[model samples]
Target: MPETVTPLGDGPGSEPGGTPGGTPQPPRGGRGRRTALIAAAVAVVAAVAVVGALGLGGGDGGTGAPPRSGSLVPVTRTTLTERTEVDGELGYGKEIPLPVRATGTVTWLPRPGAAAGRGDTLLRVDDRPVVLLYGALPMYRDLGLTAARPATPAESAPPPAGPGAPAKPSGTAAPRQSAPASPRQSAREVKGMDVLQFETNLAALGHTGFTVDETFTARTAEAVKRWQGSLGLPRTGRVGVGDVIYAGGRIRVGHAGVRVGSAAAENALTYTSTSRKVVVNASAADASWAVRGTAVRVTLPSGTTVKGVVASVGKQATAASEGGGKDGSEQGGAATVPVTVTIGDQRALGRLESGPVTVAYVGREVKDVLAVPVAALVALAEGGHGLETADGAFVAVRTGLFADGKVEVSGRGVREGLRVRIPE
Candidate 1:
């Protein structure tokens, strides 16, 4: 009895007597997987707690390290301001019109596309020795000698005494007043009297229908009235200031008109004004940048450089064209004042009409402004000004006019003459 022991289960390879081909088992695979998952979760929590304690999680985790001090490379900067904007147009000296000489039909007008300059011949007329008839009067005369007229002693008077009064001299002649102008003396006197000579020549030319005088008189008035009547214009009885007349047939030339042409009864001549050759328009707003006498370096569409001097600046605003997209979006605003720049080369001007060009204006510059490297700024985690200091400290700076890899900065906390560090 003492040695006998009951067998509770199957031993080794033998199955339990009461069961048929069955055995008890443990959940080993499931327990191993669960244990591994719990260990991984604990490890993650421990790492996060360590980082928070070390202040490596930023302020969000109520733990952040103090900013470190570092060295910075000091640099100076300038503030550039835009002054004025202006529009410019191109023109050539050849644009001036030339009148036809001798009246036959303008045998040849300069070819449509041909260019000409101040001295270039524009139109040629038929052959005819334009019968040159002197005007009843000319505007100038070469007086052989200076003339003097006898003056009454009473008329020669001394100047009144005053701060600028002349002191009496031993032999100084008394100043004399000019005599009142009379028609008779004026007509006879030829001392530097161009108007009188002009009349004399006209009289000699057999154009006696008019009398010459500086002042338009009844005779000249009658002549003008007659001419205007013949020309079918209102008989205003006044000769236009610069009007001209010829023999063969009558042709009228306006003031400053008719460079090489003549009025012959049966000839047709070209007419042109002899004033300025070209005109340009540009903007007042941009005028500040486009100063007078500025040497403008212009780059044309073909990559040619044309030198020009800014001649005139507009005082007021003017219309201008601005850059725009096909969809009507604008690239920039248009200039208000139109500035005019005169180009010296007539050939260069002729080639620049309506051509693409780039113009740069250098205005006033500001120097010695506090500046920082552009790369030093970091988008802040707190949504505010973000710039890194040389000591690795975070800072906020007010900045302006970013150019040439630097920005102008100024603020209450920022100061000049202070050594600061820039982080690498």
Candidate 2:
């Protein structure tokens, strides 16, 4: 039989734990239930205390797992201190655009885009202008002076026999021969011949105003002036060898419907610009970072290395060359003021033709400073952040020089040997 349970101050025939009045006996089962409830409550309290200490009860004020940390290594002491960071591009300092020197058919000795040296022949003139002169007295003299003298009719006279002596006509004067014809010379005769020759020569040209054998009179000079005006020249009547002459600008040769002919028109040579000046302007923000004489390096299409130096720093802000400027400074006005960098070696010019490149500048260096990856430093809300301590809590830290992906952090709360968590 199970042990019988008893209530305090209760008799066998009375209610369990009842006062002394005669009452019916309470059930042993009720007494046993009260005792069992008390025991179970005590066991539950004990279990909760164990769980709380073990951190299983999350609200028990224990941080679940320690934050992860990475080891730090010593960096070369000479690498710290950089005040400014800037981006820059490469460009040319000086350039020359070769322009058209004379007007004629376009021909290039070295095909377009070819390299040229000083004194290299670029092109040749196709025709040489020529002049011819002639005398005019021959025809005029024959019509006037020579024909003016009338021949006297000879009187009929018997001819003397050659073999046997024959009687000659009495009173027959010997026929007088006209004096040898004297050539009459005159400016008009000479001038007329010149006019004819000039017309013939002018026809040989491309219907241009210039002509050979043309009387080089005041009219000729005026015509030359008109030609000069059309060609954009100073209207000077005289021309020398190699002087530029143009029938009209934009005149092309060897085109459709134009017969190819050798004339003074072909002699006109035109000069055109094959190259130009190009420069790359840098931003003013880079001036302080990029000091004068800062060395820059670049590579060419041929894998050739080129060197350059910082030549100037902009004192004011101005529009940039590449994409204009920033803010409301206007389309071209907003560019960062210029910082000019000239190439140190001329050989580098051969590789550059006014294009893009890379530039770098060095800044101040520091020594023997405690540093870590910039990622490890957590900026504090007040002024800076903190780093994780071995205890899993962040400690306030003061930071110094920041450069090359590293920063100098120091404070009483942080030590060189302290393990700090770097937030991923």
Candidate 3:
């Protein structure tokens, strides 16, 4: 049976002045159950846990050495940590749905996992490409000339040929050739940051002829025409609603929801950032444990450890369901909160796209304290836990943080470097 509290008012037995160590007593009955602050590692935990004198030194009462077989382990002062590890998933962060603003049949789609950069075609609707532009604003209105004005005969006349091309027969009715000013240049123009966004893409695509500003000019329209022609679309100087879409930067296709023959509708595809990230579904009770911006460690599939930080914590809770359809549905599984983690180094993850990973969350920490291998702790005869001195004395100790293979200990008699007996 577990030992009765000896006399160590703080724990079991103790001599005067609060120092543990009264008289040793052999276990009086069968082994009893006791909750131990033991580590979960197989190498650290023993098959059977013994208590009292029989489990420790096996001596009568006061002795200079153990009466039975054992080894001496000294108490050491060190820092201990409380850590909790949970399963995590590796991926390209969350997917953002892309709305198809054009009205046409989906004619083409890039393969999933393909990446699209600024000014690149994300999808082709009715054979017209819906190009991707870099910007925070979405394409909600026409950003170029709304309509082109009718041209006069003089304005319609062509300019003189360049030096490389044959001269227009010495201008023999070259119609007094002269470059006509763009008609829309004098008319009102579309204005806003959206205009600047399109112009930015236009300049990146090498179709620059206009300044990058918030207002779309006739030159901007000309640039748009050139860009459209390169994509095999009609050279309409005006950009239509289905002409393009905008995002922050390069994105990878996550999934294609529209088929080549299907009618194009909203949410035509999904895209995610090009970088790899980690997602963890933590237990709901761990909300406080996984605070935002908390630093953590992740173990990759190759056993390589990488540093990570908690990028975001979700407030909503979700849980898996247990199937019991007809008979009667049962309660759902434990609720969990979603957490996102970011890794700074791309080379560390290598070419891994998605897989399972382990995340370690640091909890409480105890500094500069006396501790010993958890295996050395013994249940007191009366109640509580204590450690055995190498000299065959029982020192009732109050336990603190438990981590690694050691447990923090403190008591009147417990001191650093003090030898404790470990049953072989």
Candidate 4:
């Protein structure tokens, strides 16, 4: 058999005798490259499978290994204050119109920022001072003294003519009894709710000896005389319609509609509280959080921050109209209510008249409580949310206030410095 074996003819790279050139070569380079590509593909598939398993298992590898270092967050003990910021306007509380009942040329007017106290002259019409008085009632009539009258006709008339008196002359009319004049007949007649207001304010102004009632009496006239005398006016014991202006309280002139020499009509001036406050028109839903006495932070236009307290929360909601549809149909808007906030530091407002401001209404507060990023909370199959531990374990937790991207959490194993996992 060995003697019968024959050598095969070689191709291009091999010599015929096949001594030194080369034996038929296999495709080593191509095979090696193909094997490498297959191995690379297998590795990629394995890695993708591992990531898929981790994701499916809720941030935990099926092997029960801890999460990646970047996904761990440590529980912290800190104060978390929940707050909401709302747009507000920095200025006096509310604008109140000061209407002038006296029709005449405006003689004098207070400067826009002038602070007028009760009994202070707000403005002058026809050279008569229109004084400011704190009262809830509007002055509608003059205040003056009225003479007292008999309570009964019998008391007012003389005893029936003596029966013994000669019979009335035939066709002779008995002495005509002049009908008593009505209280309104006198030029000094004074009667109205305005009289009650005048008496109230006079009492507040240190004037005494007057009952605060709707009826004007001699005692009321005395008080009026005292008030008039204090103002350097004649003691006429009377108050004309334009003599006083009623308002909720002392006011700072906000605007003057009528200048000197201008006719004083209904709305002659606008005034507001002298103290600076922030007014927020909050949506009805958000109004509940803006309770009176709630602490707040006010950011002025100049980037200044000041402490404040909610002074009042409006009970009534006001509807705001956005606009009409293209066909002129009405398009309704949100209902909002006003919230008044008073600044604790008035000096910080400086010379700013009115500007847009931001009011952060502080809500629930968690002090020195265990808290974690909201992202760290996980929904457990059992019921409530839980905090995932570093070891792929979830500790049941009771959640409290949520604020500023953090949540107040308490549980068996959730304490400060305990690292929790946040799914990436």
Please provide, for model 3 over 229-294, each residue's C-alpha lDDT reduced to its tens digit, 9 standing for 90 to 100: 888878878888778888899999878877888988777889999888899877786568787889
User: Which prediction has more favorable lDDT, 2 or 4?
Assistant: 4
Looking at model 1, report the run of 10 residues with the lowest lDDT sum. Answer: 246-255
lDDT (Cα, tens digit) per residue for candidate 1, span 80-127:
443322223343222322222333433333334443332133344442
Pick the TM-score winner.
3
The superposed Cα distance between candidate 1 and the true structure at residue 249, in angstroms, equals: 33
All candidates: CA RMSD (Å): 17.5, 22.3, 18.9, 11.6
Relative to the true structure, how large is the alpha-carbon lDDT of every model?
Answer: 0.46, 0.46, 0.78, 0.77
> Tens-digit lDDT track for model 2 on 1-424?
8998655457655555565565544665897898999999988866654443233423212233444446544323345756332333443332222222333443333243443322233343343221111222111211011123433545334455688786668999977765654433211222346344333433433234644453544444456566446445566554433332222112212112112332223322223222222223445544455567776555444556566566666666765444443332333433565556666565546745555544445566677777777777655434455565545455566778888888887766555666665655
- Candidate 2 TM-score to native: 0.37
Q: Candidate 3, 65: how far from true, in Å?
A: 2.1
lDDT of 1 at 213: 61
Q: What would the per-residue lDDT of candidate 4 be over residues 112-164, giving only the tens digit for each residue?
A: 88999987898888887889898888778766765655458667667666868
Please report how far candidate 1 places residue 316 from its true position, in Å: 7.2
